[model samples]
Target: MSLPFKTLIKIERGNHLPMYVQIANELIKLIRGGKLTPGAFLPGTREMADLLAIHRKTIINAYEDLSVQGWIESLPRKGYRVVSDLPVIKPRSFQPKNNYPATSISPEELLHLPAFTRPGMVNDYQPGALIVDDGFPDINLTPYDFFLQQYRQQLNSGILYTLNFQKEEGGLLSLRTATSSFLNQTRGLNITHEQVAITRGAQMAIYLAAALLIKPGDRIIVSEPSYFMANQIFQQLGAVIHRVPVDEEGMDTNALEELLKTGTFKLIYVIPHHHHPTTVTMSTARRIQLLTLIKEYQLWAIEDDYDYDFHYRNSPILPLASADHDGRILYIGSYTKLLGPSFRIGYLVAGVQIIEQAIRYRRLMDIRGDFMMESALAALIDNGELSRHINRSKKIYAARLDKTTELLTSSNIPVSFHKPQGGMALWLRFDPQYPLANLLTNASANNLHLYGTAYFEGYNTNYNSLRFGFASLQEQQMEQAVSILAASLKKK
Candidate 1:
């Protein structure tokens, strides 16, 4: 099945690009055009050179380029063949007829392809600026030395490299085991490592669950002022979002019940422990009622307890999954709040079937999470270092939370907020006279960085509020930040 190479690949010697690149580009066109099918072996470099009347080295260079780009693979004594797993692509009739361009294509031209374009929230805090971040852990508080030591041990033991090549579907087995034990002890979840799938973060876990459960036009319920990023993911997947109001008691389960009666819903996204943007924990009564409704409606629930590790006032409530006997709840959690966001480790706890399917779906986007880091985290959990660090950080953040609350109360800035029992960040509402837009502009001028209230806005409602994160700020920094807020308020 040899093709006419000389006629198919038109060599333009007058073109400025290298001859090898020209040949490589022509072959790529053939492969993409379905002329050269997967597993089809290429002619020997010498044979190809003889056929094309070119230098053998040029053919070698072209093959090398193709191999590096993963278009073709080399087999021992078998020569080069196209990779078997590549998706079949139809030729673009819009492209110039058999005329390949010599110059590199611009990314701007590539952007014309049909794809979702959602920009992520960027953390662009400048150095020397006072910041009220969005409830992120202070990186300075992370036990990096201990974690690095464990990471180095994993590197030296050679387990990381072994696990990298091996297909450990969910994640490293050691980390999953450690995580299972840790959750059972701390959150009362009765599960094994087989029920867990490690993800890059809670965001990825949410995306994976949505991908598995939702279909186009399927109805899903979310809190009115829920995590916006999760809402974007559901919408992107073509799910219709129904918002239920969230008060101090948490997602008004009564309102949710009413909505459930009107239509069929596939899933519900709830943040029971310190609900994002509001910093309110769902009452025990509401949790019970919500769980009962979930069973009644046969709805799948994504219970995101992302910051369950840092409770200050009392012991945190056990996750909804702890009581789920029917495997209706998919629990999502993250280590980003405990170990700084840079760590990027999280997990989804569910039935073995869901875990297995989520792992398969995860492969489509990310092959696997960082094994070395997961192993190191497992060691940290086993050695009690992570628990100790969390205990120590809780006390410091509690004090910071108190100090910030007291200072803001005394400052007379026309602001009101309830001191949260747990989690990082305070939800503060400003007087309507003081627009959040103006306050943000004024704060920016004073070198004080604060997230705008736009993110927390609900459908057809504007709540002039912001989540004032205090965990990342020290006492003196909190004082300075409060002072800046007062000044911003006074600026007309």
Candidate 2:
């Protein structure tokens, strides 16, 4: 009998890392470094778990990730085998000239900055999840065939290859120009090309904006309950976080002004149109008030309009940038929500002064930015495929949203939610406060992985809530998911 793989795996608890990823990465390194040769059969998950003295589920998650990523093939009864048939990993460019310095920064300093980490909810990021992930598009509706054809055309143009290696502020010209046009037509903003700085995604756009605008101990205002990720970014930038309460209309501008008078904050970040985590769109009057406050206080407002594309309800809302005549507001938009995240493109609309600073910071982070994907996306948008994709996607999400709402509401499940207009998700609150987070965490055993409102804030709110992204689940699947979730919630 072959020795169990657990005997081969060793973990140091002092490392403070998740056991699943630790084991997974070790296997990946063994394969990539060519130690684990092809066709090797690995130990069964339960056998390895027994040997490691860890949960069997942990081993399963590791195996699942490897399977989804095409690193291994699982055969019934025989166990898992290495997939040496997988192609060699070759990232876009930059032949390794030297090693990256792995230096340690203060934990305090590290805590306040945005992490490039993503939701590890899925085994592999499926195209379908793009609707739920702010970076994903409706994979079912995307015109891949047309895009592949256009990609080849752009590649043959010869301009794309040169553009791919440098972190040109605002991405490539062909791409930037196309994005600017889309912004103009959709949001009604009068912007010249020079003011737009393309970064990786909205997260990077927000990070660059916060890093440039906020200083250590500077005060900045955010919605009382807003995007957890954005809050993480602002806190990482060392901004003194002040949460201005938000209502149906949007951020409490009056409270914002009062906070400004105390001489506490230098910047205010608002989701405005379709405020994150809540799915409430701000009113036009509030937008005007915020712009006025920004100029009067001489403070900058960072607008994260992450999902302006698929307005499922009325006409798409205008971005705060559209109304910024004084440039006091920094507008951040992401193609990640509309385009594929592997594309890694987002833009910042701000005064030329801030744009210049952001460019310097971006270059410091990564010498070369994404070019091939940016170029391809630009061509897709230039040809109007992006708009079509968004429209089709919105319709599909809207239908799914309606169905999800109905299923959860009408089901025997003990949960309630508010219907959002055009976004991909619904915010839900469970009854009598079941341990939603823990339950969701444990529910992985049932093959249902969903998001729970655990990390939404620094402190515990003591409520059982969840944010469900309907974009990925089919209309039919939403009912079943809710049914399973309802049963999961009921379990003591």
Top lDDT: which candidate number?
Answer: 1
lDDT of 1 by residue, 55-163 (tens): 9999999998777555788998999999885422121111111111121111110011134321122257567788777888888889898777777777788876687
- Model 2: per-residue lDDT, tens digit, 1-492? 564455566677765346775687677667666667688877788877887899999999988867755678898878898986643322121111111112211112223443453233546543433222332355666667766876676677876666655556556777777877877667766665666788888888888877777778888888878777788887767778888877778888888888888885678888976677767778777777887887688776788885777666666556767663366677898877775555567898776666666777777665545676777777677644565466556657677777877787788677666677666666666665466655565454455667533332244454455667777767656666766676666444
- In the order shown, what is each candidate's alpha-carbon RMSD? 22.9, 20.1
For TM-score, the strongest prediction is: 1
Pairs of residues at least 3 apart in sequence or in different chains that clash in candidate 2? 112-236, 113-236, 130-136, 164-371, 170-198, 312-422
**TM-score against truth, every candidate:** 0.74, 0.71
lDDT of 1 at 315: 62
Give the CA lDDT, 0 to 100, for residue 142 in model 1: 93
Give the deviation of candidate 2 from the true structure as CA RMSD: 20.1
Indicate the TM-score of model 2. 0.71
List residue ranges in candidate 1 displaced over 4 A: 1-127, 452-457, 490-492
Each model's lDDT comes to 0.79, 0.67
